[model samples]
Target: MNNKLFSVIFSLAVAIALVGPLFAAGGGTALQHANVNVRDTAAVQRGAKLFVNYCLSCHSASYMRYNRLAEDLGLDEELVMDNLVFADVKIGETMDIAMRPADAEAWLGKVPPDLSLISRSRGADWLYTYMLTFYQDESGGWNNLALPNVSMPHVFWQLQGIQKPVYATHDGIEVVDHLTLGKPGLQSPEEYEGTVRDLVTFLDYLGEPAKVKRKNVGVWVLLFLALFALIAYALKAEYWRDVH
Candidate 1:
């Protein structure tokens, strides 16, 4: 009994040792909810437009193709070609930029990462919050609340407007508590938030274009399994009636 107790205790200790870091790692910052719905076709379409206009210049969605946009976004091939296709890329080619890696590094101090899997890698909430959190700092550079000291500039600053960090002194050190909107941009705060939400929704769809189809298939598969189980149970009952 004593040996068994020791073994159980040892197992629990090992388990706790393994699990403790995961909890510690997760305790950093609370993320704001993105509330993104990729099924909203209109929002996704708007997001796609926003991406093509603002984000595509620097970041490339290498895994996504222009024709795929027409299929997924309910856009006409002609509209996509006329409006979204800027480079000499064909309709079937993957989304790529003309900026070379060395040029990108020289211009932006670092090469921007491909955004094809960014939504999957970083949660939708993180992306949404990051997009909206850029504020003017002391060094005249933009700072993000979600990701501190981000290298990327606020490309959408014209739409979202300028924000300055509100700071409070704590123990002789000033710390940024929140942001205050300084200059009004082309969009109101509410409008900008909605735009960001739509953009995040589009990114979510880009990360997994087959997500909706997979969900539909999953539901059908579950229904078929349930029906099969019911029929099997009924057949078993019929066959075993005489034995019982």
Candidate 2:
């Protein structure tokens, strides 16, 4: 019976291991850490501005509102109305694009998805890495190290400059081993990395607006529990002392 049970458990474990990769999204190079901090209001604010300027043109954060940015990022309502709302949208309306779905599909062959929960879906690290890994391909198209043959062009190419993939033969197969920068962009590598980090931070916050508050509250709760545990231990000790 013990051997039969062990074999069954081992078989189940092996099956899970074999099936895991099939369910994983976007198999590619290892992701870089995003180091996102939702509590960093200034970083998140900068990220929000970047997203509005670049990503909002293609993707809509349909679940988020323009006025919410004013409240959360400490921006004035007038500024948000003037600068962020590029479409025919009111200040209080959700962040939606003006382009119709058919128009988007006709242009790009597929409609860009809404980005409100993208960070949660793709994870901050994957998004951060994907944003930075675009490389020039032979066909004049762009490819991503994180998601190979991706259709999206490097929209931030001006800011990030250009990179080319370095190929190497491994076990009789030529593969892109890494990327090498060809031209310098407006920002240095370190600066661009910082910018991407900020963007990821904002996306992370957008996925869960209450995360920072919950994290803060969790710290206080832990402290309270520690204090209560100490008090309870003391009371128990006192009660046991009389029994002895």
Candidate 3:
């Protein structure tokens, strides 16, 4: 009944109201674990290569510089320029697409989104699941369980092959029970999964290049705080001993 108690209750209610939608949005299939490790330098390197080959033509990581990526992933400047640099861009330049926005819109009916911060916004698991769940619909177009009716085609179909969805009725509504490989691709399923994992790992790194450094520094900061706290406690006790 007091003003302070009423304010606390109102804050809690507002928090619940804001967070309710996130919980409600979990009605679809459970997201699979991405298991991305940004510390795996080889994996990130491979992911960077894959991104440049398959995704760079459409979606650009415009916020990230090629030289920065090389430094983070421990790649040589010349090697990056020779292999990863398809466009006539300098090593210090940002990863931008050559495709015009108008051309992309006309071709795909929508512009593909920039992926610099996609891992941060969508999470690694969602990206992993989205990458793997592409299936050939009855109409012969590509669809995904993670994002149904998406405009993006199965760009990795040659690597992952054709996947078909098994339908089952869920409360009188038909839904995909699971995906089965209808046709094998160039790589085995395990290989494809590993490739996707590597790509996701690279994306995770791109989202926050300083994440590992920050975590390492945080440990030292905590240790210093603990030591300081103990020292402060000892000083306080010594100062109060004579007074007591």
* Cα lDDT of model 2 by residue, 56-97, tens digit: 888999889888878877789998888777677888898888
**Of the pair 2 and 3, which is ahead by TM-score?**
2
Backbone clashes for every candidate come to: 0, 0, 0
- How many backbone clashes can be found in candidate 3? 0
Candidate 3, residues 1-27, lDDT tens digits: the string is 999999999999999999975664342
Give TM-scores for every candidate, taking all chains together and pairing residue i with residue i: 0.82, 0.87, 0.83
Residue by residue across 1-244, what tens digits does model 1's lDDT show? 5999999999999999998754542313456788998778899899998999999999999999999989887889989999889888899999999999899999988899999999887879888888988888999998888777878999889999999998989799977778899888899999999999999998999999887567768889999999999999999999999899
Best by lDDT: 3
Clashes of 1: 0
Cα RMSD for candidates in order: 4.0, 2.8, 3.7
RMSD of 2: 2.8
Off by over 4 Å in 1: 1-29, 170-172, 226-244
| Top of the candidates by TM-score | 2
Q: Residue 219, candidate 2: how far off, in angstroms?
A: 1.3
Error of 2 at 171 (Å): 3.1
